[model samples]
Each structure stands twice: as structure tokens, then as C-alpha cells.
Target: MTTVQSARGPLDTADLGRVLMHEHVFVLTPDSQRQWSDEWDEEEQVANAIVKLNELAAQGISTIADPTVDGLGRDVARIARIQAEVDLNIIVATGVYTYCDVPNFFAFRGPGIIPGLDDPMVDFFVRDLEEGVRGTAVRAAFLKCAIDHHGLTPGVERVLRAEAAAHLRTGAPIMVHTHPGTQTGLEVMRVLGEEGVAFERVILAHSGDSTDAEHLGSLAEAGFLLGMDRFGIDATLDFESRVAIVVELCRRGFSGQMVLAQDAACYIDWIDPMFKGALPNWNYLHVLGDVVPALLERGVTESQVDEMLVGNPRRYFGG
Candidate 1:
């Protein structure tokens, strides 16, 4: 059986039961928070995440693939702290997150500075996968990069290419934060395809944000696993539309090519605390609490849900 790295340590893929393909224990802008936010309490945040994750484990979601990477302030040590308290497995990612520009850390150090020079991010990502992240001994289990409405800007392409190169070096899978409304997954299919990343080795995340079943179906047919993740963020798309897309895709016999998640984070500094009140259901429990019940009502079978929640993730981890 194949094994994948978790925040607690490595685990057999089969042990990753009823997986949520996307979720973040924390998502923050570290430098900004440290400089400006008084609400950034480390101890409290960790404690709160433990409580919430324990609640998630109670729902039978034994694993969550957290794609919080460099730009989003990923701290493996903090994750280890929470993983220690919870019954669930937290699989972290390694890659850069950028919709437009590469992080300043990567700006001038790579090939764009001068041709034929290898991009350092590929080695950095590979090291996080092979070795452990920043000496935390919590190795990353997957790669994450994004292509948003900004499209594949030069910086975005660089990060995506590095993730692809790292995937070639290591068999660990990839998760691309795609803006399906922009049809960015197609761009990913082209870029990653040219880089020799097999479609099965990648997940097109945030596919649920789009109501375009035809667009999602094409990607599934192309062999990429779709993350009908983001079940609770109804602000972008209403609850009914999100459920409808998943139902439609499953109707077309693409359940095996999909994975489910809420894309919720315990403490995200991205939104204003006042405004965060708008998304009440955008928490860890939305999938179990609401989405699944709605799906079953709409004719998505128990086995289809199992394929999306269990079988697909196991296969993605190479189980």
C-alpha cells in the first residue's frame, strides 16, 4: 500500500478515510498579522483549530488535504500541534500561491533572471516532499499552485511549472487552485500536460465554484480529478448552484473523478472579521451537515458520495 505524509507523520493511504480534499487549519498573511493584527493569538488559534478538527473527525472525515502553502503562511509545526490533539490526518502542501506575481522570495533568483538557470522553486518543492518542510519533520504530501482570473501571468506560470517539475521528480500529486469561471483548468491542462504531468496526478481545485457542468465534464473526461471542493462559500455561488453542479457531474457518471471538501479554514486573515459573518455555513461541517443531505435528495447515490469522498482520494494518494 502507498503511504502519504501527514502532519502527525506518514500514514497508509487507506487510513485516510472519508477524505476532504481541501481544507486549511489556518490561512494567514504572517508578516501583516505580526506587524498589525492584535487578534493573531497563536495559542488560541491552535486550540480553536484542535476543537474544530475534532468536530470534523466526529463527522467521520478522518483526513483533510490542507493546501495552505508559502504565500498563505503554512506552518507545519503549528499543524503538528493540532494534528497531535485531533484524531484526523492533516496532509499539507508545498508550492507557491500566486494569482499574478511570484512572491518576492522567487522574483530574481530563477531562469527569468537569466536563461537556462533552473528555477529554485522546483528543488524547494521537491525537498519539502522528499525531506521535511523547514526541518519540522512534517513533509508535504502534495503540491499546490493557482491560476485565477488574472490568468497564467508570467509569475503564475513560473510557479505552476516549478510544481510540475517537482511532481515529475516526486510521484506526489498536485492541486491547482483553478478559477473554473475563467476556464483556467484548460490552461492548466495545457501547461501541466506539456510538462509531462499526467492528468490523474493533478486535481483541479475549486471546480465547484463554477456552475458550468459542461466545463467540468470536459476536464473530468480529460482525466483530471475535479475538486468539487468549497462547499460552504456560498457568497461566490449560491448553495443550490454548487450542489447542482456536483449532482450533474455525478449524473454524467463522473463521480469517480471528483473529490469533495469545503475549503474552510479555522483562522483566515484574508477577510475582515466583521465581513466573515456573512458566511455562516463556510465551516468544516457544511459538507456533512448540509451538502451530502442535499446531494442524496437530488439523487447522488451513497456509493457516488463514497467514490467522491473515499475512493477518489485514496487513488489520488496512490493507494
Candidate 2:
């Protein structure tokens, strides 16, 4: 049986039912929080996360593939604590999350910086997938990297290449936080393709931010899973447009090539908590309560919904 690692332990991939391809229990700037913030309360935050995730599980979401890694402030031990209180399967990932440069931790070591040295990120990522993350038993189930509008700087390229190398070593599928507005997915195709990583195993996240159907179709046809996530974040692209694009793609027979998510998190330290009120539906249950209803009302069949929410994610993880 093919199994995938979750925050709790290894579970049969078949058990990873109704997955939200992208979601986070928490997204923190640990350094900033430690030094400059007094709002963070470990006990309260952990309890809040359990309450929110339990609500998601009660909504029938069996798994949430969280891509919170190094740059996003991953804490596997803390995640395991939250997992112990919830019955949901949380699939964590390994890879750096940076748009412009590698973190200073990698600045002088690896590759071009040191003439004869290798990229240590590849080994770290592989170890996270093959063994565990941060000395904890929760092994990462997939690889994640980012290439935003800043494009591929030396640091960005290093992270992407390291992610590809890790994928090649562990067969863990990849998820790239792409900036589709600038068509950065094209860069991902070129780079990962050269690394011998199959496009079918890559997820071009935030593809829903772009309403260019032709561009989306081309990428889907090229075998990359389009993440029509960020459902409730209407600030980038409103709800109507996001739903319309998905309906159109399903009408064009691309449901098999897409995955759905809110990209929501219980707590994100980037934004002011008061500002979060502006995005009321930007939570885990928005997909089930709002998006699915909107899709069906707009003529998306139940089978197409299943393909995006269930089958596509399963296939992504080799279930």
C-alpha cells in the first residue's frame, strides 16, 4: 500500500480523503514574533488551532496538505501537538519559501558561493521527506518552493533547484508558489523540466489569481495541477471571477487537472488581526460552504467537484 506521511504519522494514501491541497495551521514570522510581538500566546494559539481544524474535520475534510516550511515558520513539534487534539490528517511539506534570495543561513555555503561544495538544501529536504523534520517523527509528504514576481534571482533559483533535486531523490511531488500574473509558471516549467522533474508532479499554486483562461489551459494541458486556491481572498481576484474561471475550466474538461483550496490558515502573523475581518470567508470551511455551492449553481457537476477536491489531490500524492 502506498502511504504518505502526516503530522501524526504515516497513513495509507487512500485514507487521505477530501483533501484541501493547500492550507496552514499557522503562518508565523518566528523571529519577529519572538522579539517584537506580545500578542502570541502558545497555549491560546494551540487551542484556537485545534478548534478551527476540528471545525474543518467536522465539515468532512480528512486531510490538509500544509506547505508551511522553513521560511514560513514550520514547527513540526508544535504541529504534532495540535494534531494530537484533532482527528484530521495534516500533510506537511519541506522546502524554503522565498521569492528573491536564499535565506542568509544559506548565503555563503552551497554551490557558486563555495567552488567545490554542494547545495545543502537538497540533503535537508530529502532528509525531511525520507526521515523526519526538525528531529520529529513527522516526515514531510511533499516538496514546496516559491518563485514570485521577483522572478528567479540567484537565491530563488537555488531553492527551486534544491526542491527539484529533493523531488528526484524522494519522488515527493512538488508545489510551487507561483506568480501567475507574470506567467512565472513558464519559468518553473523550464527549470524543473531541465532538472528531469515531470510537470505532472508539479502544482502551480495561485493559478486562480489569473483570469487568463488560455494561459491556464495551456499549463493544465502541459500536465501541471492548477491550484484554484485562495478562494476567499477577493482582494487579488474577487469571488465571482474565481468561481467563473473554475466553471469555465470544468466546461472545457480540465477538472481532472485542477485542485481546490482556500490557502487559509488559522493564524497568519503577516497581517493585522483586525484587517482579517475584511476577508470573512477566508477560512477552511469556505470551500465547502460557499465555493462548492457557487460552482454547482453555476453548472459544475458533482463529479467535477469530486475530481478537484478528491481525485486530483490523491493523484498528486500518488494515492
On lDDT, the candidate that comes out on top is: 1
Alpha carbon lDDT of each predicted model = 0.93, 0.93
Model 2 clashing residue pairs (backbone): none
lDDT (10s digit) by residue, model 1, range 1-319 = 7899998888999888899999999999999998988988889988899999999999889999999999999898889878889999999999999999999877889786986689999999999999989959899999999999999999999999999999999999999999999999999999999999999989999999999989999999999999999988999999999999999999999999999999999999999999999999999999988999999999999999999999999999999
Query: Which pairs of residues collide in model 1?
Result: none
Query: What are the runs in model 2 whose C-alpha is more than 4 Å off?
Result: none
lDDT (10s digit) by residue, model 2, range 98-187: 999889998888785885578999999999999898768889999989999999888888889889989998999999999999999999
Query: What TM-score quantifies how close candidate 2 is to the native fold?
Result: 0.98
**Cα deviation of 203 in candidate 1 (Å)?**
0.6
